[model samples]
Target: MINVNEVVETNEMIEKENLDVRTITLGISLLDCISSDLEQLNKNIYNKIYEAAKDLVATGEQISREFGIPIVNKRISVTPIALIGGAACRTKEDFASIAQTLDKVAKAVGVNFIGGYSALVSKGMTPADKLLIESIPLALSTTDVVCSSINVGSTKTGINMDAVRLMGTIVKETAEATKENDSLGCAKLVVFCNAPDDNPFMAGAFHGVTEADKIINVGVSGPGVVKTALEKVRGESFEILCETIKKTAFKVTRVGQLVAREASERLGVPFGIIDLSLAPTPAIGDSVADILHEIGVEHAGAPGTTAALALLNDQVKKGGVMASSYVGGLSGAFIPVSEDQGMINAVEAGALTLEKLEAMTCVCSVGLDMIAIPGDTRDTTIAGIIADEMAIGMINQKTTAVRLIPVIGKGVGETVEFGGLLGYAPIMPVNQFSCDAFVDRGGRIPAPVHSFKN
Candidate 1:
């Protein structure tokens, strides 16, 4: 039972701070909707998602109003289309049709985004995986509300350089395809390694085949709540600071647990998990980088940033695990430059660099997210970056992703405005050094020896 003090505190978090449920994602598996006929397959896919998610937006609004908790976005994630659509979608155009169907259903159902236009080739690519990878640029550019992802590596199997190389070109094509919108399509495509099965976030979220036929996963956001709490404990010892973060995270996760259970019950679906990620927003108060600053770092890219982030990420999980039993998904701090004002400021001030961000992802939940690079950046260079991040996840046995946007026609020092949640950012310059030879070696990087844990 939530006490009056708890309720009052939660209300304060919502009112004063930027506390809110970041997303209520309905995970709908599309394996059962597969067919050999393209048109039939699309029909089945549309009906399945539209029917399953029909009540999603309304239910989210109802929960927000009744509970006084703001549910920011209602979204959906389907099974990897490459697994099921290969039988029907033979060409890139066919895959675009499926993307169109997804976009149409998402709009019809009133959801903000529908994920799972994805392929998973951690070790090697199948014919289907290749098709999906090749179709990513066309599919994402031709549709709205449809997001895509590809997982090219895992701890169990090393990085697939073939897929990595291909995706670099695909990402460039996506930028070119959506150049009219400031390369917004690149924002909707994420390349991940060790991608979680139950992530409730967009672009990277997908209803893994291992998941239930249908489930509800909620991502809780409260960077402002955490930042506000830390303000009081400023200049305190690390022990005191960790305690403050733990307690704050505990309260935040509690709200998420309640919302997840309520949503599951009302939607008549099983509750998946509460992703207690301190997801930041473009809003002033809701910045994860500010938390780093509060932790005594001058800025997010300062010398102590990585250590500060390490402490924050670990304490968040420690505080969150006790608050809910079904804790899954990437449950830590996300440092998306476009979405976090502090991060944007750090970058603009030249305090943060791409290399610094790479090191930071080593300890954080995700890696180098929402970064905009110069348009003419080499595809080989992009592949090299993805390979490095994948190596981190593979070695650390944790999830790491790269959501890089090569803003077409934009170079360093120029800001691209992707209004709303996809905030504007100064295009960060990349190393002009060539990695063509390294990326050109199209072979798999072998798994680590420690993978023999079984």
Candidate 2:
């Protein structure tokens, strides 16, 4: 056990570096479970996931208790359902049923969420893709832990307008179906460009084609630890601050690597990537917004937030890469609007706006996650937000996503409760400009020019 002096040192390092363990995800590939018979396929999937992750939650809890640090989330990601059910299901019902089975396995194992009820429709939709999209609302509404995503854009294939349009309707439907929770179900759906296959994060985590049959990925988070550490080191020079942050990130990511190794070894699964995204929680100490405030922003989403995030991202990636050779996913800061209490407070106080958040995404890991908008938000406006994020990812050749909630009957400044994990968000307003012209030019935007350097 670490002594009080060591604990003080750890806290100092955490505050100075803005470092914490974000999440630890177990990836279970379901391709082998695919069968012509729908029931057989579902059964195979359930057995595979259940067998692979039965001890995941228990293992995580044990590690957290032993380490004396919090492991924020324990999650599972599986092979994209579109491909897994391609040979079995001919209709949307099959997709819904498959998602239901996945959700059941997740709950049974005590995991917070199960991702990969999703599709990669960047170029075009397969028969299975269409069905998967259609069944997403039903799947998410009925299941407590199921999350979905659609990859409609990539640097190689550009953005698929048709698929994007379909997702707009899907998001609206998902929100309306879960209207009692202020469109919380839609908060669990993300649209991504350059989505990672081995991501251990929620709403957008799915095992890609390149992934092995089964693997363990860890995302470590400790915003509270980071915040506490930052408070200790007052009036440091910028270079000193950067060095401090890098060292702190190194320690946090090392802890993540340790947990990942133990979990993978015990589970008899191949070790996957460690995503170093600084995911926030709703607690007071566990906040990315508080980190910003500690960094002299005084308020999150303020003028200095973007520059601060840029520095934070660079320092985190440098430290995480040094800590683990297997680092992947969006390995930087996450500024999800609803999940962090500071962010919700800022939105409610009108200190954070959509435009400022967009700028922050340029420097953060993902874009516009869990943002709540007025109930009357136009579909075109939602599409515009997604388009902006995809464009950023395509041009920069990085992964970015948007998961915005259009709360029913809630306008700007109103609050919506999404219960545990999803949290609550204050409704934000969007620009009222007509994006119909841009959205109507609905052909596939070709891959970026710089994508062919190889």
The candidate that wins on TM-score is 1
Off by over 4 Å in 2: 1-22
Model number with the top lDDT: 1
Give the per-residue lDDT digits (tens) of candidate 1, residues 1-454. 7689988899999999989999999999999999999999999999999899999999999999999999999999999999989998778888889999999999999999999999999999988889988998899888989999999999999999999999899989999999999899999999999999999998899999999999999999899999999999889899999999999999999999999999999999999999999998899999999999999988899999999999999999999999999999999999999999999999998899999999999999999899999999989999999999999999999999999999999999999888888888989989899999999999899999998888
Clashes of each: 0, 10
TM-score of each: 0.99, 0.94
CA shift at 197, candidate 1, in angstroms? 0.7
Local lDDT at 387 for model 2 = 87
- Per-candidate Cα lDDT values, in order, are 0.94, 0.84
Q: Please give the distance, in angstroms, between residue 61's alpha carbon in candidate 2 and its true position after superposition.
A: 2.5
Q: Could you give the C-alpha RMSD of every candidate to the true structure, in order shown?
A: 0.7, 2.4
Residue 417 CA error for candidate 2 (Å)?
1.4
lDDT, residue 75, model 1? 96
Model 2 residue 236 CA deviation in Å: 3.0
